[model samples]
Target chain A: MNSSSISNYINTLFPQFEPALREKLIEQVTIKDFKAGEHLMQTGQYFRSTVLIVEGRVKLYREGTDGNEFFMYYLQPGEACALSMICAAKQESSKIMGKAIEDSTILMVPITLMDDLMKQYPSWYYFVMETYRSRFEELLLVIDSIAFNGLDQRLSFYLQKQQEQLQTNELQLTHQEIASDLNSSREVISRLLKKMEQKGEIKLYRNFIELKK
Target chain B: MNSSSISNYINTLFPQFEPALREKLIEQVTIKDFKAGEHLMQTGQYFRSTVLIVEGRVKLYREGTDGNEFFMYYLQPGEACALSMICAAKQESSKIMGKAIEDSTILMVPITLMDDLMKQYPSWYYFVMETYRSRFEELLLVIDSIAFNGLDQRLSFYLQKQQEQLQTNELQLTHQEIASDLNSSREVISRLLKKMEQKGEIKLYRNFIELKK
Candidate 1:
């Protein structure tokens, strides 16, 4: 997108920003493109800049010491990673990982400008706070699912969320991929998917699962 | 404590605030006392004001639909509940519950003043952001524990955290209480406690647990 289109898109997403502040943001931000399946971030890596998703989707997950990946959530267009902003602000390293799930465009703002933006723009401060609050709530919900809900329930919920995010009933992921995302073994995920298919909740193929309403 | 002492204490705890802003906070805030076991906040309840803990400890937990309580973390003196601040700013209801773990004194700042404070005081904005960042990280850690760690390891980590927070090796809680906090059955927790005791990791007493290390 051209500079004017980018500015308009950002203004549309965060209309609370003053025109001058919006212009400043447009001037300072550098747009970066990532191909599908590219790593946007990794655990233990320092955040050099905070990102704002201008287009496409990003998958976020937490990595275990043994290289296990547990799916966290996804960031869509107009959404920024709350952890990135916070870690960038505090000069801390990331404990989670992010990847581009599709061809994506992101606006990256340098960490040096964070303090100035907060002081100069009320909209920036509000946007950051809202992002943190929503993400915090999402993390708590994830904990609730793990702590209280059964594995089957969590699997169903996970599938539903995936469908919602992809905007399709068909999910193009293998049972092994699902297992990795949920921190389960391939055999267990396969069994669960078979059970779900038997119950008519989903139809499983070789490498895809279709959710049935 | 007297008003002057309270002011001095708050100033010490949140040294980021400017003198004038601190004076304004002192003028606007009201101190409230809570006995141990008193509910500071409940799920689905609107936060009329945000709290800053001045004395004692507060326990935070998420409650399931069936009333199962999964302990999240604690708010010690000088710490504020980031959720409360965010919910107050957004005028949203709380999804987690907070209770006084001991006789506690808290300074309550009305929700109406949150906007004014954010706009007028850069220190207040920074403090809010820091609070959100730390709490977000804590939630992510909780997710890691539940998703990847074994129950026994989680129990050990939970007890260690309790000991750290209460500053005592001897924790005053029943097996049932611990089970509720961890969202496990009493039998399961009792079994784990017995195993820990057998390993010389802890000594279990009636309604109490003493860490050996």
Candidate 2:
């Protein structure tokens, strides 16, 4: 909202960044907000700046030709967008989509100052590297799931991830939504979920899933 | 190899690097050779250095619990191993496997110098970023294929990629290998190839396939 609040956001959420780097971010960043269910990023869009989430949640996914979305991962208040950095550094168009699942806010750092920041601040430099490293690992995990695991195992993993990210056992998602996120048919997802329920792994409701602890 | 040969390798393969950085690489990088099929990287192994392919081809893949190798992509001359950099930066263990598909040589740059190089050489910094970007995009494409496409389409993409990378219409591969790479059954791959052949797209022999123009 204001300079002081922006400073508070940086200092509180990204205290690992050096004081001067945080000051630079406070000075240069343009804060943008997105309402729930709004697109934060879209495929074929060129990124002008890298984004750091300051509030709420964002889900990143790959879109299919048929408009199906294969869910990737989420960005929380303290995380930076990996695709944003990758596309921004190369000035290339995004191959994926990001949506704000909740009312969200992000601070955008211009690409022009990337080299300067990497050189000027050691903390900022490692922060960028660490961001790439974490996101890279996340992508690798996603690949492992899709490549090695069966659909039932993948659904289990999907539920586990949702539980971990939302920090709740009750996942507010429909069967159709799960089917869409996994790029599977609703009938198939329903069959697998019913099997999970039979196995005592979960309880399914109309629009939510309760995972057994 | 001799220092002069190493200098030649750097000068010839990576002329984009500044002279000073090239000199530094020649001084610090260890030249290691791998016989065909030798492991360059293993799942759960720690990485001490970032690898750059100087000669021959390396196949990077995800290994499943049953030791199934889902082909990721190939790393050729002038390319750095993105997983190597990601794991080295965090001193984390690798999650994937890399093998020399052909007899190969690589320049191993110690992880300790990564920070110094990033801060000192703009070219080196951008090179590292580009390596990660390319690998990330490759992984995304793999995800897209698996999540969105059916087996037949996936097989076609697999063959197309193989043709492009091997730079030959005649692919020196077996049905078993194709099935293994795509994480499908040998019979299924054979059936798909037969269909492609019936369509006059290719001619399959004992160990290789010849793509028709």
Candidate 3:
């Protein structure tokens, strides 16, 4: 996208950004693309920049010593992944692997620029405050689901949420991905999906599932 | 604590506050105390100010339908809360409740004071940024634990963390409190605690668990 388009998008999301500051930010940002399955970052790497997704998707996951995996969530266009990690784990240790779910483009803002902008702009502080607040709220939801909600309810809620957010009855998901998200096994997720299909709640396709009305 | 003491604490935590800005903040803050189990703020209450804990502790949690409770950690002295909820959730829709854990005193800085401070002392932006970053980080750890760890592991981890952070081998926690935190039944938690005690990993008192190293 052109600088003008980026500026407009940024302005729409944060109306506090002044025209001059927007211009400076647009100048500082470098948009880069990645194909599916490309790992953009991994555990132990220093996080030196904040990323705003311009297109496509990324998933953050951590692997355990027992060879098990837990999927945090997916980052969509316009969302951020690094900000939360950096804030929580510090710049050097906030390492969850960021892998491409598709051909993705991201607007990268270097930490140096961010530090400068935070100093120079009051609006930037407000923006950061809001972003962190939303991240906090999202994490609370995830925690609630894991603590009280069972796997069946969690999976159902996930599918319902996905159907609503993606605006589609069909989902581009695999059993293993769903398993990783719910902290269960692929076989368990497959069995659950089959059960749901038999109950007419959804239909299992080759690589996807379609929710039934 | 007097204004100088409060300012000194603020300065120690936030470098940007320095001496002069810290003095300014001390002028704007007022200290007040709450008795144990007193509601500092309820779910539907609008957050008109942010608080800096000067002494004692505060519990942050949410009560769901059917009277089920979920504990979202406590705010220790020198910590702050509610900036994210104030910015993100609609005034009446946020699902959180804050209460004084004991007879506690806090320095309250009204939102208007903060607004003025941000304008007059842009350097103090770092103070808000630091608090916001820590809140965001804590939320991520909660999310990570929920997504990857089981109920037993979560309880173990929570006890271990509290032991470390509080710098005490004996944790003043009730079975009901532990159940609320784990989002499980009190009976279950009581049984588990008894089992852990029998296994010689811990010692249980009337309202506490002493981790035996």
Ranking by DockQ: 2, 1, 3
Q: Per model, state how many residue pairs clash.
A: 0, 0, 1
Candidate 3 lDDT, A34-95, residue by residue in tens: 99989877666667677777677787665554555556667787676645334332454554
- After the best TM-score superposition of candidate 3, give how far the Cα of residue A31 lies from its true spot, in angstroms: 2.7
Which consecutive 10 residues in model 2 chain A have the weakest lDDT in total? Answer: A1-10
Range of the 10 consecutive residues with the lowest summed lDDT in candidate 3 chain A = A82-91
Model 3 C-alpha RMSD to native: 3.5
Error of 1 at A36 (Å): 1.2
lDDT of 2 by residue, A108-180 (tens): 9999988899999999888888898998888888988998899999999999999999999999999998998
* lDDT, model 1, position A9: 67
- Give me the candidate number with maximum lDDT: 2
DockQ of 1: 0.77
Cα error, residue A110 of model 2, in Å, equals: 0.8
Question: What are the chain B TM-scores of all models?
Answer: 0.94, 0.98, 0.83
lDDT of 3 by residue, B150-211 (tens): 67677887898788767899999999888877678789888888888898999999988899
lDDT of 3 at B78: 68
For each candidate, report its DockQ versus the true two-chain complex. Answer: 0.77, 0.86, 0.43
**Number of residue pairs clashing in candidate 3, backbone atoms closer than 3 angstroms, sequence gap of 3 or more or interchain:** 1
Cα deviation at A139, candidate 1, in Å, is 0.8
Instruction: Please give the C-alpha DockQ score of model 3.
Output: 0.43
